[model samples]
Structures are given as C-alpha cells and as structure tokens.
Target chain A: MKYKDYYEILGVPRDADDDAIKKAYRKLAHKYHPDVSKDPAGEEKFKEIAEAYATLKDADKRAAYDRLGSHSPGQDFQPPPDWGTQYGEQDLRFEDIDLSDLLAGLAGGRQRGAGRRGTMAMPGEDYEVTARISLEDAYAGTLVDLNLSVPEYDANGRLHRVPRVFKARIPKGATHGQRLRLRGKGGKGFHGGRDGDLYLNIELVPHALFRPSGHDLYLDLPLAPWEAALGATVAVPTLAGTVHLKVPAGTAAGSKLRLSGRGLPTPHGKPGDLYAIAQIAVPPKLSEAERELFQKLAAGSTFDPRSHFNSEVKHGD
Target chain B: MATEPVEPAWLNDDARVSLDELAALSGLTDAALRELVDYGVLHPVDAAEAQWTFSARWVVVARTACRLRNDFELDLNALALTLSFLDRIRDLEAQLRSANAQLPRRHY
Candidate 1:
C-alpha cells in the first residue's frame, strides 16, 4: 500500500496538537466544502482534507498511524507482519487496503461494543453536475447520457467506484445558470432510506451567432451602408429557421429590430423575442470608382455626427 | 438492459409546496421553517394560509441552509443571514456572467 502522510495533507507538523489540526481542517473545510465552494476541484480537495483530519483528530487512530513510521507520500510500503496483531486486527490485509481504510477501520474498532445497531435509514447523497448545452438544445428538449463513477462498498467492504450511466432528459427552455432537479437520481439510499436527488445546473455555451439574455436572443446584424440608408428585407437566422426582417430606412447602428416570439420556446408562456442589433459594415479597400462616389457623397452630405460632441448639453432644434 | 431514461421536470419560478412537504424535503422541522419565513429567509406563496405554501425551489434553498448549518455548526439565528449572503453572492456572479455573455464570444 502507498503511504499517505496525513500531516502533509493538512500542512501540519506531525507533533501538532489537536487544536492546530482542527483549526487547519475547519479553515480548509470552509474554503473547499462542496456545497459552499465555487472551485472546480473543491470537492476533491475537501475529501482529502476531511480524510486527513479524520485520522489525525482521533487519539487512537493517530497513534496507530504514528507506529507505521514515516515514509514519503505515495511511497510503496507494507506494514510489519506483526502490525495487525499489535492493533488487535489480524484479519485485515494491509496490502489490499488504503491508508484511509486502515485508519477508518481502526476508528470503527474504537466504537465497537457500544450497542452498534444495524444500518439506519440514511438518505442518499445529492449529486450536482453542470451540464453545458448549446442554445439550440435549449430551444428543443434533449437527452444526455451521464456516465458517473459512483462510490460504493464492495462485497468485502472495500470502497470502490462503480461505473453507472443515467439517461437524463433535459426539458426545453432550460436557460443558462438554471438548476433542474431530477427526482431520485443520485446515489442509492442505504437500507430503506429515501433516495437522493440529482441537480443539473444548466450552462449554455456562448453561441457563435447569438447571445441569450433570459429567454431573449440577441445578435449583431451586419448591414451595408446603402442597405441601412434604403430599407430592405433581409433574411435572419433564428433557432428554428431563417425569417425575413424588414430594416427601416434611416436605421441607426446599435438600434434593435425586434422579431416577435422567435427566441426561445417556453412551456409556461409565449416565446421570447429575438433582437437584431444593426451594425453597419463598410468595405475595407475601396476601388477608385467607389472612392470617388464616396468622396462626392461626403462632400455633399450636411450630416454632422460630432455636432453634439462640441457642447456639454445639446440644444433642442 | 438499457439504462432507463429519466425525464426531469423543467424547473420554473412557479410550483407550490406545502409546509409539510418542504419540511420533509429540507430535513428541517416545521417550526424551524416557519421561523425562517418570519426572518424573510424564505417567502411563502400563501402567507395567510394555515399551512404556508412556498415555491418548490425553496426546498433546495432550505436544504442547502441545513447543510451549511450542520457543516459549520452555525446557530439557527445565524443560518438565515448566511443563506441570504450566499444567495446574494450567487446572484451577483450570475449577473456578471450574463452581462459578460452579452459580448460576442469569438472575435474575428
């Protein structure tokens, strides 16, 4: 079995008092606990921290661990043959067990002969998975197969992760940051306890062409200067398909053209609107003829875009 | 055998739960949930009803609060304040993310 230095995991000295170990555990627990932490690896980190503290906090378990002598973290080592007998646990084969397993068994040994009842009805643990989907999927309901390695005890009472696949049907209209609870979808309950739930926190991938705000979709529509100046019917893409949008003459850049009830479809109410924000596109390299025409239009035009920039407050004409 | 496909209910801002169900789901007593309602930590859909009915989402909130309370050994009085602050933080983070999403994801 590979040795895991409980002291190193908690960043404490081997001779550190219980108070120091507790302080370290509490501090790390507050930072990395799964429910409160936002860090991606917080749960894993908290598990290690919790396991380390679980051993070092107990007097008997800590002493048993101390007797194993020091070895580098993860170094392959086997306990002395007499080690099991010294701890009154001769049946446990150290080679097949983790350091955590050894320590945890010792903890259970300490609590033995205390009227330990059979398994109680404890609820299963809740599972939270962030499911990232596209804007198109949110428009239409889709199914996702979640392959999760769930921890469970083997026939020999050794902890192992059993692979399980669950098909989750995400309903339509799931927006970004939305949380959907799948009833009884988490870890199985112990004995006759109530099964836990699985929470799918929806994360919508940033769409290439569209930006979603709540149910509404926004996209920048590129329009040639002439098209903006002279009204035209242009085809715009929606989640379903393309639709013709009439851009009014004299439409300013950054102004929105609303496509009613074309955004996302919701079950509770009418669909949201799609907004096309106008953005005027100009040719980067102009031909000689185009340059001459542009120069003529600029020379003839009386529109002053910077007229308001000259005054602190504009006067109403 | 095929893994049974489970269809999840799309959660909305609506959906009511009575006090008894909320208490059972949250792993909290009815009186404690009522106390939370008094503190404005939770809002009931029907406050005047003999058994208050809350939005179903509050079950998650109350359970989260319970977890925090047990994990940190926080007192009941302090649980409401902590939950409110956490909710605000989550809201602010979500607001920031959506506001940032308003910009184009990829730039040419």
Candidate 2:
C-alpha cells in the first residue's frame, strides 16, 4: 500500500507540539470546511485534513505511525510484523471514519470486519443528496430520474462506489429545502442490520417567466401605452393555463393585479395568488404617421411626469 | 437495461427517529447527543433519556452540528450556540430569497 505522510498533510513538523498541531488543523479546517467554503474541492480537502488531524492528535496513533520509518508520501510500504498485534491488543477502533485505502486496510482490518470479531450488527450510514426540480414540476407532480453513485463493500471488504439508477416521483407542493427520506435506500448494512435511509433535499430551479415566492407566483406583464391608458383585457399565462387579466383604466406601471388562487396548488388551506405586475412598453421605432400623431398628442397634453421630483426639489431649496 | 421505478418515502416533521438511528446518521456518539439535549440543542419527543425519540428532521440538524463540532473543535455549549446562530442565518436567507423572488426581473 502507498504510505501517507500525515505530518505533510497537516503542514506540521514531525516534532511539533500539540498546540502547534491544533493551530495548524484549525486554520486548515476553517479554510476547507465544506459548509462554509465555496471551493469545489473543499469537501475532499476537509476530509484529508480531518484524517490527518485524527491520527496526529492521538499520541498512540502518532507514535505507531512514526515507528513505520521515514518513508515519503506515496511510497510503497507495509506495516511492520508486530504492528497489528500491538495496536490490536489496545482495542482501538475507528468509528464513522472514511479513510484512505491504505489507512482503511490497516485500521479497518480486524476491527471493522464481521466474522473475525464474531457477528456484529452495525447500521449502515445514511446518505444525503440534493435533487433539483423545475417550478412546474413542484406545482404539478412529476417523475424524475436520478443516477446515484453508492458506496458498497466487495467480497474482500473493500469500499467502492457502484452506479445506481432509478426514477422517483416528486410529489406536488414539495417546497425548496424540503427533505424527502427514502427508507432503506442508503449504504448496505453489516451482519443483518437494517440499511440506512437516503435523504433527498429538494431544490427548485428558477423559472424564466414565473418567480415563485413560497406558494405565490409573480409574472411581469408588459403592456402597450394605449393598453395602460385605456382599460383592456389581456391574456396572462399561469402555470395551469392562460387567463384574461382586466387592467383598470389609467393603470400605471408597477401596478400589481392579483389573480386569486391562480398560483401553486396546495394540499390543504387556500391556494396562493398570482400577481401580474404592469410594465408599460413603447415602440422602438415609430412610422411617420404614428410619430405625427404622437407629436400632436404631446403638443396638446399638459401631464407632467416629473412633478413629484420638481416638488421635492422646491421643498429642499 | 431498464431501471427500476422507486417510490420515495417522505418523512414529515412528525416522523420519529430512535437514539441509535440518530447516532448512526449524525456520526455523533450517544453521549454527545445527550450533551446536545442538555445544552438545548435537541428536543426529543419524550422526557425519558432511555426511550428518547427525535423527529426525523433532527437528522439534518445533528449532522450539521456534528460537522461544525469536528471542524471547530467546539465544546457542547458553544456548539449549541453556533447551531442556533446557523439556523437563524438559514431562516433569514430563505426569507430573503422569498422576498427577492417577488421582485420583477431586470433584463439588460
């Protein structure tokens, strides 16, 4: 097996004090912590740091590791003849440890195996993963296909990830950040223990036209200048279908028109409302006749759009 | 080859989880979980420690707490406080997201 330099991994000297080792670990831990870090390799780096700290922090493990000699990292080596016997007698067991293959072979040999230590039942580890779905899928239930790489143990008790594929149903009203647990779908158990559960964290993908806020939906409704000036019934799109929205006379931009119970459907209670926000749009280029008509209307009109700004400026002066 | 269609079992807030199951899922020892309870980090279903039952959502809570504890080497009390703060941050972030979703999209 390839040898691992725990000291090198932690960026500490071999003879460093406990305080120094801890300081180095804490700094690295903060930098590589998966929850806080945005780095793509943060999880893997954190795992490596944790493994290094776990071995180096313990005096016995550090001594045992040091006794293996001055081999460089990735060097091919084996534990001394009496190494296992010495550590085995101490009843040291590594629990919930995701170790490298070399360390797993050494630490997990007799203690982790089932038959050699008699039949023992250990519940398999639970797995958590995020599943992203569209807003439409969240509104109306849909089937989603998922390909998972699940870790499994071989006949020789080695860990390897095997590809698993299945289709799951995303229930209606499944909100963002909701966790759906699948029973007995995680890692396989040992010695007849029950398999662990899998937790699917729901993430709703953003929609192009609709913005979802809890159960409510919002849509930007573009209106012509004449449509805003005069009351008009226009078609608005909802998740279910298109419906006609009545804009009141002299409707201004940024006005929100609420359509009751037109948003996402809920299992219980009142369904949410959809809001169509008005945005008055003008033609980019007008023809000669249209320009002449606009010019005549502008010459006749006395409406001041910046009256509020003028009032505020006068009051300030 | 055809893949199997799996029906997912959704766990609600009311779903019960045993102490051992919680420990296995969270990677925290039973003693650490008890300490968490003492520190007000976890609220079990019943008062008795022996037959204590937790909600299935505690699995996520406990796992997150366990990760923070391992990364920071924090004591139980500090860990509990940190977890509470983290929960507040998550809640605020969700609220912000919901509020932002209500705003009209800007097309440049």
Using DockQ, give the best candidate's number.
Answer: 1
DockQ of 2: 0.46
Q: Is the docking of candidate 1 incorrect, acceptable, medium or high quality?
A: medium
What TM-score does each of the candidates earn?
Answer: 0.85, 0.77
Off by over 4 Å in 1: A1-3, A34-38, A58-70, A75-117, A155-158, A313-317, B104-108
What lDDT score belongs to each candidate, Candidate 1 first? 0.79, 0.76
Interface RMSD of each: 2.8, 3.3
Tens digit of lDDT per residue, candidate 2, span A71-116? 8887767667676577653332323223353244454433555323
Flag regions of model 2 displaced more than 4 Å. A1-9, A13-21, A38-41, A55-99, A108-118, A266-271, A313-317, B1-3, B11-58
lDDT of residue A110 for candidate 2 = 38
Q: How well is each residue in A1-317 modelled by candidate 1, as lDDT tens digits?
A: 88998899899999999999999888988999887898989988988988898888889888889989999999989887777888776566666557776676564533421112325665666777888889999999888878776655555554444678888888887787677788888866665777777778888888888888778888888888888989889999999999999999998887789999998877578888898888888987899999999999999999887887868777687
Q: Model 2: C-alpha RMSD to truth?
A: 5.2
Each candidate: chain B TM-score = 0.87, 0.77
